[model samples]
Target: MAAARRRNSHVQRQRACADSLAEFVERSPSSFHAAAAVADHLASAGFARVEERDEWPAEPGDYVLLRDGAVVAWRIPEEIDDTAPFAIVGAHTDSPGFRLKPSPDRVAHGWRQLAVEVYGGPLLNSWLDRELRLAGRVSLTDGSTRLVQTGAIARIPQLAVHLDRQVNSEGLKLDPQLHTAPVTGPENGPDARSIIAAAAGVEAEDLVAWDLALADTQAPAFLGSDETMLAAGRLDNLVSVHAAMRAIVDTVPSGVIPVIAAFDHEEVGSGTRSGAAGPLLEQVIDRIQDARAVSPSHRARALGASWCVSSDVGHSIHPNYPERHDDGARPIAGGGPILKVNANQRYASDARGAALWAGVCSNAGVTTQPFVSRNSIPCGSTIGPITATRLGVSTVDVGIPILSMHSAREVCAIADAHALERALAVFLAGGWPEHA
Candidate 1:
């Protein structure tokens, strides 16, 4: 009876997480917004902002820092008679969408709309027939920043079915310049600067470099008659990022090393200086050691003791194309966090690390699942392998199973958020099973 009650309570917790994640995405217009929002969450949880400047003593404690709109946080354990290992959780803040290009002042048929280029992998068809809005940061010549927010525009007119009689028989094909183009009336009237100026409370000509993307006008909502599913935009990895940040904050107060990394540019390959594949994390670790006044020898030891969990979206069994998934290893929505694996080293999960994750779930009493691609199909990857290799730490790749991954809007079971959070809480608090 007690176990059942506990499970039910956990479910409620997960439901709250899903709602919070949706809210996060709704507010985070771009990666910059996402990182800022995450920083706020960490601050609210009592983590002092860690800054990078020069060398200093590093010790174990709770810390949060950001690099070019990417956030990374961690909790340094107080019971560090020995070097404490990091319970790292990572996710990307960027999602698939179109970015506004400079000098997008073109008008065709007396319609004025900004020019945009696709960023990351996205389902071009889903974006065709929906109301869209624009939001992002714009840089000023004075070395200051401003935000540009455009109201909902239904300018991207999709082709009607009546115009294409064989639409149902043949799949939809979209052209970036044609089908996805937005119609803004009278381009001759104003330029990109003017559109940005209206939003920034400044003159249009003052607008400099801008980073903007189209977003679905529809807010996230619960789906299904029973409300078992949650639908929202940018859930591909944002869900994981939100959960991990929360779990890390919640665990850090317990005096544990809770590290949360929100890397930038994952969708386009994480090779940028601010990305997970770069030296940002390593540099942060060094700063922590110096801040704590730890010696060089101890810093090396502390690093060796750390562990990482790379959080990203894993493929859920798609109902429309079940054959694309591995029959023996399918992850279902609402089934709990999925452990991703690949023999080609796409994901960082090895048999040993996989067992550790299972242990963490078991200890937390959080239900767990697995995801493996079919032998014939290639697997997509996350930062797990990259981080593990860079730091020489044992890493596990895990995430909530999501449908329509890389789509403009993604879906996932409402209950899985809590499962991942609970499991992460356990892992962050308990340290490694062998040491425990």
Candidate 2:
């Protein structure tokens, strides 16, 4: 009876966590929307919003900062000072997709299309014939920007099989410029910008500039016979974002400062002002130290004691392509969170960091798996190395396991997602013995 009760409780938690995650993904269609959603959620959780133009609060409490498409939130304990070490959880807000080009009006043949360019590497074929929405922010002539998203108004139609006899066996080929323009309406229908302006409650002519992306219109849903799995778009990094945000919101006061940094433009090498490659994290940390009035030597001491956990999604072994993964170490869905390892420094998980993560998970009563790339397969990078190198702090890369990563839609085990949040909560709340 006890075992049965425990199992039932775990199932309920998994479903509840997955439902909340789906709701979050539904609200965030673009990087800007993701950042704004984080800010709003933090506000509701009693975090005071601070702007870059104003002076930061010195008193110990919860605070958040929003910079364009990125968000950084921190919790300061009442017993803390400028010399307190930081317990940082890092994640990214952006995902791979197509961005609408300026002056996207196009009429090719009898079809009216919205011109778009590939923003990042995506599974091109996965986008074909899927209902897609246009979402992002548009700058008005009056210097104000509004977040907007059009209902299912466009689609990238795949060529008919009858017209392309070899599409299945030979595989479909696409030209980013020639084949990827999404058909919005009939050739004589309203212009793309006009449709977009209506969504933002402004005239087309009032739109001075805009940044938009094509996003899948499907809502996340449960999969499998037991309904223990979730399927949704933007699961690559949003899973990490949602997990870290929840952890930070529920964090209690501790000896170290708990921080969560979710940045944009990570899909395109993270070189922008709001990305990990830039100085956003560093600048925010410096301002925080200044407001607390810590001396230089103590600041250095705090820096040495700080630790970061870079969270993102990693690939799960595909049943059909099992050989493609490292035979020795392939994480699977529902196997709890993964500790990513790469001797090449691709992932910043050294022996020390791995030990720290293991202890955190163990203390949280969470199981974990290991992930490594096949020698022939070059591994993808995350914000872990960037944060470690730039900040010169101990860092580890960790994430939940999911399949069909980078697809228009992806799938992950609900249990794994739930386990990740539980583990993150422990890390943020200072379960590790050395965090102070």
Number of clashes recorded per candidate:
23, 0
RMSD values, in order shown: 2.4, 1.2
- Sequence-dependent TM-score of model 2: 0.98
lDDT of 1 by residue, 1-436 (tens): 9999997886677677877878888878678888888888888877777666644325545667877658988776656533555667878988888888776666777778768888887888878667787777888878889656777753577778899777889977788866676665665565666767787888765767888888877888899987779888889788888888777766633323567889988888889887889998877776666566768787667667667888898889988999999989889898889999888999999988888888888887777888888999898889998899888878889999999887778898988877887778777775446753
Top lDDT model:
2
Task: Please give each candidate's TM-score.
Answer: 0.93, 0.98
Q: Write the per-residue lDDT of candidate 2 for residues 30-52, one digit (tens) a residue.
A: 98899999999999999999999
Best of the candidates, TM-score: 2
Pairs of residues clashing in candidate 2: none
**Each model's lDDT:** 0.79, 0.90
Which residues of candidate 2, in runs, are more than 4 Å off? Answer: 434-436
